[model samples]
Target: MVRGKTQMRRIENATSRQVTFSKRRNGLLKKAFELSVLCDAQVALIVFSPRGKLYKFASSSMQETIQRYRNHRKDVHNTLREQHLQQLKQEAIELMKKIELLEASKRKLLGEDLGSCTCEELQQIQQQLEQSLKRIRERKIQVFKEQIDQLKEKEKSLAAENEMLCEIREKIGQQARQESNEDREMVALTESSENSDVETELFIGPPEGRIKRTLTSLYI
Candidate 1:
């Protein structure tokens, strides 16, 4: 008959549990000793019973083994810490490089840091600046044209005003000349009337000469 597999668990009975603890402790110590002797390996084992009894085994001095374990752990910890610090330092270096690149890019955008630029970069910047200058010049020319148009309009208005003023002056001069000619013609007519009165007086004899002739006739 084939036997069934035993299920491993804690023994409920106190005496049986103590017996099992004793047997397992001795067996575990024996296995540890054998493993150390056969393989020339260092071993340490420790156990605590339910009654607070200590059971321990070590291939070497227990204190020495514990110290060695602690030292090994310390070394592992130091190694991991050093690796972490090195990774952090590498990350910091990369971050610094990124920051420097950003700063350089910012300076370039602001029209600074040109001395270190490559030929292609310089050419690109020059092209952009030239395009901006062309746009600015075009705008300036447009503004100048608008201003010139305004000035031309103003000049046309001023020319019209000057022509109107010239016409007004010509009309005023013509009126003045007409008035002067009328005054001259009136003076000439007055002078001709005065001369005709003088001629009529001379054509008729003097009243004194007629009186003297009548007195002489009465005397005769």
Candidate 2:
């Protein structure tokens, strides 16, 4: 029968744990030695027991392996650091370019640096300003027309009022002339009636003095 796989766990008993540590340590060292001899490869191993006992195996001098490992780690660290620095430098250059573009845009918005603008850009700005001027002129003309219309209306109203006043004055003058003519006619009629009302007497005869003398002589 095939054996079932072993489940690994920490040993609960101190004695069992120590025994297992010794066996595993020896086995690991043997495997390191065999790998070096058979494969002609450099190998190193280190182990520390629970009690702080040290064990190690090396195909070469232990100090040499440690020094090589340290050197390799240092080389890797320097390579990574150089790569990071180069990446940062590239990003900084891109950021500076972006900043320069932003500053140029700001200058253009503020109406500065027009000398450096291309023909197309200048044309665009010119068209915009011209459109604004046209709008302003149209608005001014509209306002002037409105004012002129109002003035014309006022002039017409004043003319009508003047005509009405002139007609009223002429009517009053005609009525006064008619009243004066009637008064003069009445005064002439009264004076003719007064002349006609005076009294008068009339008689017809010869000389009375000669007739009286002849009659008196005869009688004497």
Candidate 3:
């Protein structure tokens, strides 16, 4: 039967755990020494037991190795920082060049800096200007048309208002004329009533009575 793989876990027996710790610690220190001698490499190791016993190894001065590691990390960090700074400076240079190009193009569009332009470039500029002017003219015409349409709508509204006002005025005139006619009819009726209230004496006695009355009226 094939042997099963040993399960790697902590040893619960205190004696067995201590024995394992001693053997592993010594083996690790021996391997570190061999690696340092064979490869001419710096090596440092430190281990602590459960009872706070220290186990340590170093192929060179431990302090010097630790200091050299820290210095190497710092130098690497500075190199990366310098590279990032150079990248930023290069980007800034590229952006400045782009801005200059844009400014030059703007100047050309505005008809400035034409001394370096060839005939073909001049013709291209002229075409661009003409296209721009055409668009401007079209926009202007559209605006004018919109204004005219608005004015027309306003005029229609005013006309409708005027028509409504005229209708109101006509009704008012009709009312005034009807009132005047009614007043005239009332006046005529009053005058006819006053005329009917006058009395004339009969003619038989009227002639003599009328003559006496008339003479009496004249004397009074």
Candidate 4:
């Protein structure tokens, strides 16, 4: 039984070592499975023989569970590191804010905010203001480029739409022209019919003199 004291050293005999490894491996696997089944726990077990053969088991994927374990352990170790880094970032931001506030206070004391700053503070403010201005200029350049791109795309779309509109307008104009010509032809034919009827009436019954007068009237 394991209750008996044994020397705290590696087993020297190859056979005994092998036997011990086998027994312990079986016990470890049984315990792993029992924990998974009874407690609904995710479990993974791995062992390598002296000959370097892989032995692995898991409640789910052996590889995935081992990887998860390693990642979880790493995250745990880095928690304090993440906190420290976050604190440093906060401190930096606070320090910058304080520097800005201090500069502003000094400016106000010198009546700069009210339009009278010492030459030294003015120089410092100018340098910082120049840096800020440069950053804004860079941002504006990027925005301007984006706006130009958008304008180019918009112009292309408008060009295409305008082309379509021009084609539609031309078609409408052509149709109107066709309709006008048809109306003119109809008017000409109607006038010709009236003149022919008048001539036939004159030839059938009217006197020659009256016919000439009618012709003159018709011409008028």
Candidate 5:
């Protein structure tokens, strides 16, 4: 019968866990010692028990070995940091070169620094200028059309306002003419009333005066 592999898990029993720790600690210490003796290599091992007990084995001074490890890690980290810095410097140089080329191209487009341009380069610049001018003219035409539309809208608004004002003026004139006719009719009625208000007094005057006036009229 084949023996089954034991599962590599924590032992739950306290006695079994202590026994396993003791066996493993002795085996590990023996291995470290043999390796150091046979190969003449520095070795360091540290183990902590569940009860906070310390166990250690070292071929050389433990503090010296740990310091050496720390120094080696620091040196490796510094080397990596220097390599990253150099890569960033190279990328910055490349970016600066690109920026300079763009600036030179911009200057050339603005009719500056033309002493080194080839015939083909000049032709390319001319084509770029022509394309730019074409776009600018198109934009100008679009702006002019927008302005004209705006002006037409403003003119329509003014015309509508003028028509409204003319209607108001005509109404005002008609009202004034009606008022004038009413005033003239009132004045005529008042004058006719004054003419009909004559006082006729028929008095019994002296008969001699009447007779004398009658005789004077007959003689005439």
Candidate 6:
């Protein structure tokens, strides 16, 4: 092939294009075979024709040659990937150092450990720390307000339960009092002589010597 002599244009004639494809394909396959034999190297070449037919050549079995090529490419990619990972690791270390410096500066600003800083530096640090603290305090207040709301809700629920229990206790107490009064009345009626002494003018009886409710009260 002539070096840099061809114009950058397609061969429009179908027959010329087909002829060129065949000749170039043969030359490429010849070059691959020569490289394999002369350099004691494995080689593989694959070409797809315009009609979608495959054309191929290899110094040995196509599978073995292709496998060798793939392995060679994989080794190169692995080396590059390792180099990239090492670069990333170095960058990560740098980032960590920066973070440590920033944290130390922040601690100094907060008036935490000022043994190493000058008075002026401490003042600047304090100013920055005050701003940060103000932000944090605002956030804390917001959280506290939310908690207070939650507590209020819980108090409302508990109050409702307490009111219900109080009502139930009052009803039970009233029922017990009514039962006790009934029991007392029955006991006095059974005595037969006591009611006449206490309320003789207001009381009446069915007959003398008649008693009522001698048995204990039944739930039914």
lDDT of 6 by residue, 13-44 (tens): 99999999999999998999899999988778
lDDT of 2 by residue, 157-194 (tens): 99999999999999999988888888888887876676
Task: Give the per-residue lDDT digits (tens) of candidate 1, residues 1-220.
Answer: 9999856987889998899889988999999999999999999999999989888999999999999999999999999999999999999999999999999877886789899899999888778778989999999999999999999999999999999999999999999999999999999999999999998856346999878877998999
How many clashes would you count in candidate 5? 0
Q: Pick the candidate with the highest lDDT.
A: 5
Clashing residue pairs in candidate 5 (N, C-alpha, C atoms within 3 angstroms): none
State, as a TM-score between 0 and 1, how close model 4 is to the true structure.
0.38
Cα deviation at 149, candidate 4, in Å, is 83
Candidate 6's TM-score reads 0.49
Model 4 per-residue lDDT at 215: 90
Q: Write the per-residue lDDT of candidate 4 for residues 13-122, one digit (tens) a residue.
A: 99999999899889999999999999999998888999898888889987889889899999987997899999999999999999999998777655469465678866
Clash pairs detected, candidate 1: none
Model 2 root-mean-square deviation: 25.8
Number of clashing pairs, model 1?
Answer: 0
Q: List the residue pairs that clash in candidate 2.
A: none
Report model 5's TM-score to 2 decimal places.
Answer: 0.56
Q: Order candidates by TM-score, high to low.
A: 5, 3, 2, 6, 1, 4
Model 2 CA lDDT for position 171: 96
**Per-residue CA lDDT of candidate 3, range 19-97, in tens?**
9999999999999999999999999988999899998899999999889989999999999999999999999999999
TM-score of each: 0.49, 0.50, 0.53, 0.38, 0.56, 0.49
The residue ranges of model 4 lying beyond 4 angstroms of the native Cα positions read: 1-3, 70-74, 87-220
In terms of lDDT, model 2 sits at 0.88
State residue 60's C-alpha deviation in candidate 2, in Å.
Answer: 0.9
Which regions in candidate 3 have their CA more than 4 angstroms from the true location?
1-98, 199-208, 211-220
RMSD (Cα, Å) for all candidates, in order, is 24.1, 25.8, 9.9, 15.9, 10.2, 12.9
Candidates 1 and 2: which is better by lDDT? Answer: 1
Candidate with better TM-score, 1 vs 4: 1
